[model samples]
Target: MTQDRPIVIGAGLAGLMTALHLAPMPVLVLARAPLGEAAASAWAQGGVAAAVGPDDDPARHLQDTLAAGDGLCDAAIAARILGAAPDTIAALLRRGVAFDRAGDGRFALGLEAAHSRHRILHAAGDGTGAEIMRALIAAVRRTPSITVLEHTEARRLLVEDGRIRGVLVAGPHGAMTLPAGRVVLASGGIGGLFAHTTNPPQAWGQGLLLAARAGAALADLEFVQFHPTALATGTDPLPLISEAVRGEGALLIDETGSRFLADSPGAELGPRDVVARGIFRHLAAGHQVFLDARQALGDRFAKRFPAIAAACRDAGLDPATQPIPVTPAAHFHMGGVAVDAVGRSSVAGLWACGETASTGLHGANRLASNSLLEAATCACWVAGDVAATPAVRLRPLAEGRLPPLPDPAVVRPILWRHVGLLRDAEGLRAALRALLPLAAGGGPASDPATLGLMLAVAALRREESRGAHARSDFPTHGAGRARRLTLNLAEAMQAAAGLADPVVLRA
Candidate 1:
């Protein structure tokens, strides 16, 4: 009910970083679960990508990012984020985060698929995300002006006139209003909407839905990056075998133990989309797929990647002795509630960062570790911008359209089957037919369904193979420059229902 302190939803890397950057100024942070455990940021294993090496710098990082984006990246945005990475890394180090280092005192880096150099800074081998989040969480907890509300879910935005006033959240005692002038949507991606994903199963694109309902512009909905090597256990939110495993000289093989990636353009170090599709073709043909890292890592697996080693042990697989069964699982989303360079959205008083905000840095395909750096740099930019906005009086609106939420069990499988790694016109159309009904507002499935429908619709339109959005129907790039689409919930829904194109809707 105040304007002096802002409210931040989703206590992930973006939210926590935003809160920390706005120090001395009071802020409210809300999370659906405990801070550290709920965020996909904590699940990042590849580490932050920065140009800290002697032969590497931001220009090279930007070039590699552009190359990986498959010509869909915003050159300006890529330069901005990748350029600031060294400073961001420095800031994290100052916050007491430990990064793996070589004996000569240089930061030890790893090579992931698509990056041109070993510029990724890791912590605790492959536990990079966990380490960064642990440090940020501790720093946030120590900040006196930051008030974190654990187990709090922001369900609605309280908008009056044309500006957002605050958020309506569900707590243990039920729904309550948290009034503020500026509210930031730092919610993570739509990974949970898929049956198999490297992200937490609870990440149901709630931020995308919340922002869309509030009339924010969303872009690149078709681009969802699938990590090529998630542990193929029958677990929800499948455990990830870090790409670093491949960086350490692992090879992808079929059930017959034949190395397949050698046929691709990037080979073992190709872009994520290529690797994922390579594995998928074999999987679709009834061949078992495995990640053959045993020869490369050998007995050093446990010492090099403790977290992955523990996951392997827990799943009844020994990494040092045998190949790990793997499959492509939904990982980072390249699209989201589209945000400006400084993190502002189409809706005033609201901003988004991290995976929830499609800031054009990732474009069609995000470079490894850029997600964490974007979260840090953009959060700071947003904090600075939010500081300048004049406070507005709170005007809470009446509750409306509160509907039963859809079960994840029903939504996840359908999306994974139709819109997973590879897609075609028929599958996308079928997906729209099934998902549009559930996304029809007034249910828990509304958000996930809406986001899924948007992606499927866009995927259908972009009938060509471009970056992560591969369509079997359209195999070629077909010439011309790549165009970016920005749509709201209604426009996206219209396209999903075969009523109108987003271009016509915008017109």
Candidate 2:
């Protein structure tokens, strides 16, 4: 590959879509795992949210998205992304994505939590992500200008004079540097930092760590969205029972068969944070929470949600015959390397899309099913930005020592205990203390610890309860208008050392 060819990290939707959109413009894609595995994109069950329904439009979708974001959404960015949703969906169809269609030839749109319209586009029932991946992966394979490196993980981005010179990657062949002037970090979320999460274990915030170490500004590191209904069968990374099930009328019930969330606003259809907290509190109260799909879907459950049904049957339970055991698990992160309108990060020649980039569309909380839309839609903008930017002269990269492979095991417990659904200053400070040394060290836990430390500092700084970040000690919204927060490694470390105020960059 030439130095001018852009390198895309991660083989998921965002990375793949970005590469495809840049097609005819040679690009290289690196995947830690094989193309289809270890990607949270393929695990998504809820369909893509778009304003495809006849009665719906981008304005209405934007309204619901802003409401879910809980006052921190970048309205212009949200409007741009949501407004392009229809065209983005059309582009997906052009890329061979076979979204489900009704008998009348219209797109089969399903509803999900916080969505006012039936605009969730699915394929093969609940296996939306898998279907989308199947199509996109096939498209990538067929594209002549795209080069894919499976089993290759990017260890560090080689930056010089504040510009991305190359990427140091470890692959099956061994460690080598790809001297590309342009790079994109599409690596997924930070859910793996939690002990119990719905995200793939590979999503331990590697993208955030890579960008942070390279001096990129990250935003909203405190806003972690916990999905309310991860199927709890004592699994490490629990299987997700999609919120679309509840959109289809499934109820949250306890051991006594009581609708435990009935009194909560929107109940089962509430914003993800609210429902997650409700389930978290319910479980803390010594009651087992279950999603009773039996009364709602019953025999139709298997047909509508084949993937979830198979997961339940694998656990020796039937969704049709019984209530499915459920619990709150870290599902998504609304924080990452902050990007501008065109997906350009603070670092020159580096761009981010998908969950890895905090594009401000998700804000404090992400509306359900909007992740796919964001990843798909923003890929075009990122690609256009990358394509238009003049390629820089490739600098001679030094053979820097490879950082020890990251292990998230040590960081998971600290986050789950202190930084999970509910947080307090004491616990957040304790997390900072425990993570500071590991983050500063050059050991196997450094990367994950660094990410955790950043999150803990952000959480401690934000005193009020807002969106996914609920401070138990301060249970109400802060005064005045809500502002989004941004932090870098220096600021986070300074705050951790108590040498500076933790007031991060607010925008």
Candidate number achieving the greatest lDDT relative to the actual structure:
2
Q: Which stretches of candidate 2 lie over 4 Å from their true place?
A: 499-507
Question: Candidate 2 on 304-419: residue-level lDDT in tens?
Answer: 99999999999999998899999999999999989999999999999999999999999789999999999999999999999999987676666667788889999999999999
Candidate 1 lDDT over residue span 379-457, tens digit each:
9899888877877766554544433443566778888999888888778778888888887855767767877887777
For each candidate, what is the lDDT?
0.85, 0.92
Q: Note the residue pairs that clash in candidate 2.
A: none
Report the error of model 1 at residue 467, Å.
Answer: 0.5
* lDDT of model 1 at position 343: 90
Candidate 2 yields a Cα-based lDDT of: 0.92
